[model samples]
Target: MAKNQRRSVTVTLLYVFFIINQALTDGPRFVEPIPNVTVPLGRDANLPCVVENLGTYKVAWIHIDRQMILTIHRHVISRIPRFSVSHDNAKTWLLHVNNVHKEDRGYYMCQVNTNPMISQVGYLQVVVPPNIIDSLSTPSSVAVRENQNVSLTCKAEGFPTPKIMWRRGDSQEITVRKRKVAVYEGEHLNLTRISRTEMGVYLCIATNGVPPSVSKRVVVDVEFPPMIWVPNQLVGAPAGTDVSLDCHTEAHPKAISYWVRDNVMLLPTKKYGADLTENSYMAHMKLTVRNLQATDFGNYRCISKNSLGETEGSIRLYEIPMPTTISRPTEVRSQLHKENLAKRNVSKISQEERVKSKMMSSYDSDEINSHREIENRHESGNGYHTPSSPQLSGCISITRWTFPQFAAVILNCFFYHCRV
Candidate 1:
């Protein structure tokens, strides 16, 4: 009996020793392989650390130099808002620092713990301040046609919200004119929309409002100041007839209302009477081209421009009673017409009639061509053949030109119109 008891005790002792050896050799598993990181002076940063099979052992974070223990499991042991450490799903641990300061630049350590075993430690780093050496000065001046509204702006950038103030170049002292200048951002110093009268050498002051104010001088030039607006067409008339392209503009102290031909202005005269309207921005000059010839093909930008500045916009005009074969010209004439449009010297009423006639004619051509194309395709079996393959499992019919590319274009046009 004594010998049997001795054997049993020996076996039990061996089994316990084996288990202890395995536990000592195989410690907790490390999840993330990372080096200690260094961060900037004033920025946000995160340090990552993780351990697996972390069920029993608690985790700890300690700042080396500070000797301050930062975290214990999910509980952040630091009172400062700048310090926080959290373990998500018991997998990885993170330390987040906010709005870092220069003094905050230092090393941090991540430590893991388990019963009956030594702790594991990791490191982190932080860096601060940035290079500040660059020039900041620029505002381009431009000539604008008189009697038009203009907007000018100044832009600058820096660390720690740079102060931005605009001063008229003509003024000896940099004064903030309430209506003329207002700060878009107190920090970066951005100004939006200054009028032509506000154009001149202006100073941009960037200071934390501290001792030495850093100022970048900029000159804002208002360019080509012209005033133009959409014109209303003349009294009712039937569709599909001759049409005129009409536009109007005026300038301060009145500028010549002319059609911009390759950047030059054409005045209405004998062949075309000038349709003029007077306004503070418009020069009371309108153009009406009679007989509206193809030679007049191009854009007509109503230019109410003088020596001060010039500005213009485009109005689309289409051909009336267009030929069936040329229905889809691939490109619309309205935009292209702006580049080399004819501005004959003509009255407004006639110009209006001309435009009406052209539009009606184009619409009529579109309808007839669409009907004819459908009929022609239907008459030919090959042209109107429907896909019979199961791969194309959908119903298709005649009388409609449906294809992927055409469908995309239609969708795009629909969206564009919606936006407009």
Candidate 2:
């Protein structure tokens, strides 16, 4: 009886030892540690849940935030196409997310279905690259006058709020807050008292330690008052000839140009012409004078006006005299002789002198004899002269004979001179 009882105790001890050894060797336990995962946007992510001695107890993955079940063992229970499941030898259970987005970042729970569910949680951190928002940002190109203030803004969105940096696109130094800096860090860029050198393209970069940084190109246009330049300030042209005047101008906000003569606006007419052409920020003005006259010679101003200011460039128009030819001396002598003859014919006779001369006395016989002698000499030289009487005749007879004969002879001589 004692032998039998010892045998039963040994058997019981062996059975208890066998049971303890089985319990130590066979049970589901996590073999690999679940670690926190970090992934960039638009990339694939993997969450590994590994087990050892995992028998029929299936492994399941659940999203903690929404309490949504993602997978059970190797089968995906989630309706989303991006969520998938895979395992190797019932040991490694992987939850795969293809093309992960910002919303995919959260805590994922890996649970084992035992008598009471056992679970381990790991956090998924999704990092996103920078993206620039166009609507909220300022204009891509802006125009501001010199010596004025201007502000630029950059807006961006990302997983982590992106930081904005301002830099010159041409690699030049930038002015910020009245100080010159190579690279400025801020969402708002303020420039005070802008200058001509500050006109260029600016780059606004947005970054948050993510791959593929984004940038925007912004152009800065610095405007100023209209400035005029004329190559020839003094212009000369001959009368009855065409003349053209030109003036070049540079300005922003575009300037309107016209020609002004002596402060009077010159319009396009049959004798005057005006033309204007524009290229970028420059304007070319031309005023053409056809059939130029003496009155057209004066100071001409090219006036340019804009929203900023107005300016003028002046040009002088001078008249060139017409050349004349010299005449012969014979022509001048003939002209003088014709003028003397006209003057002699238009002279009036004096009535007092005629009456006194007609009543001659006998005491003047010597003078009368001298006159008769001169008359005889003239008659001997040419047949055109007539001889006079030596003695004085009656007043009525002398007046009648001399007056009629003298008047007829004078009329014949005047006609003969004009025909010659």
Candidate 3:
């Protein structure tokens, strides 16, 4: 009976002690549900695990997908330097990741060892920003010719494949398929029938949900044949004066320009000067002529030649005569009258000589003398008087008189006179 009572008392006391201990002890219970976390690449991340009644129980962190232990209590088990453990008293445990990477993304579990292991899982998501891949993208500078087709490609890499867009560096709208598009969306950009206006810097932009969009610069060069223009095609300069001729041109690959005159190339000399200046694709050519002369009056051609082609513009030089004074009206009239009178007299003498030469063979000298006397009297009234001479009277009479009857009567008198 004593042994039974002792056994029964010890059992009762042991039961009471077990009940007391049970009332004092508590199993690990989560203070709140574990929440999912997100972090950007190259940043830090914290996975929190809060528990109550965690006395005498150790907290562990594990990578669930990798089936690897990361932290036990306050010590980190992973060899990776970025992995660590932190705690706030006995109720809170945190798994810290420094400089998070894409590989650190996935489920992480917080587990406690007890009668049966208790665990709560949370996910860590890492996002990577966009970045341009220079090696695969188009070159920084590209050269092509006008009216030719050109294509450019832009490449980028990111956690999520990046979207590429093309725009003008000046922020102007881009031209695609003859239509103006605010922004071109594609990895490849093609330009057709390119012209000098299309030559400039282009921008390739890459972006996604991540922050800090990236961009690259590409330059487009459009080459073409040389084209020449002259502001003044016909320039004039006076003798002994200085003159300048200007020629403007547009070309690619820098055309060789010069001045030529009368199929001969002109060089800079004391009398001639030439200069060339360049502004982008346009070139200004100037030719100066000093001490201009009559020989300088001609056509001058400004020639520009390049591998693509050649062109020329012409300027003409001319001589301007100096002004002269006019003569008085009276002097001009007197000179004109004298010239007219002399012509009339010469005509009369020539006609008279022709008649006399023919008639001299037939007519007698006495008859010719009487004819001359009558003509002298008629001519004396008209401001023309001839001196009389007996020997030359017949010849002079024939030249002065035109009537036959008067000449006959005069001939009778002359015959009588001759006989006497």
lDDT of 2: 0.83
Give the alpha carbon lDDT tens digit for every residue of 232-344 in model 3. Answer: 98877678888999999999878999999999999999999999999878999999999998889999999999889999999998877654587989999999999999999
Would you estimate the TM-scores of all the predictions?
Answer: 0.27, 0.57, 0.66
RMSD of each predicted structure: 34.0, 24.5, 21.0
Model 3 lDDT at residue 45: 95
Pairs in clash, predicted candidate 2: none
Runs in model 2 lying further than 4 Å from the true structure:
1-25, 115-117, 143-146, 221-223, 229-248, 257-300, 316-420
Candidate 1 on 189-256: residue-level lDDT in tens?
33334344544565555554333456555554544446666674332222343445566664444465
When summed lDDT is taken over every stretch of 10 residues in candidate 1, the lowest stretch is 389-398
| Model 3 per-residue lDDT at 112 | 93
Q: How many residue pairs clash in each candidate?
A: 55, 0, 1
At residue 389, candidate 3 shows an lDDT of: 58
Write down the RMSD of candidate 2 (Cα, Å). Answer: 24.5
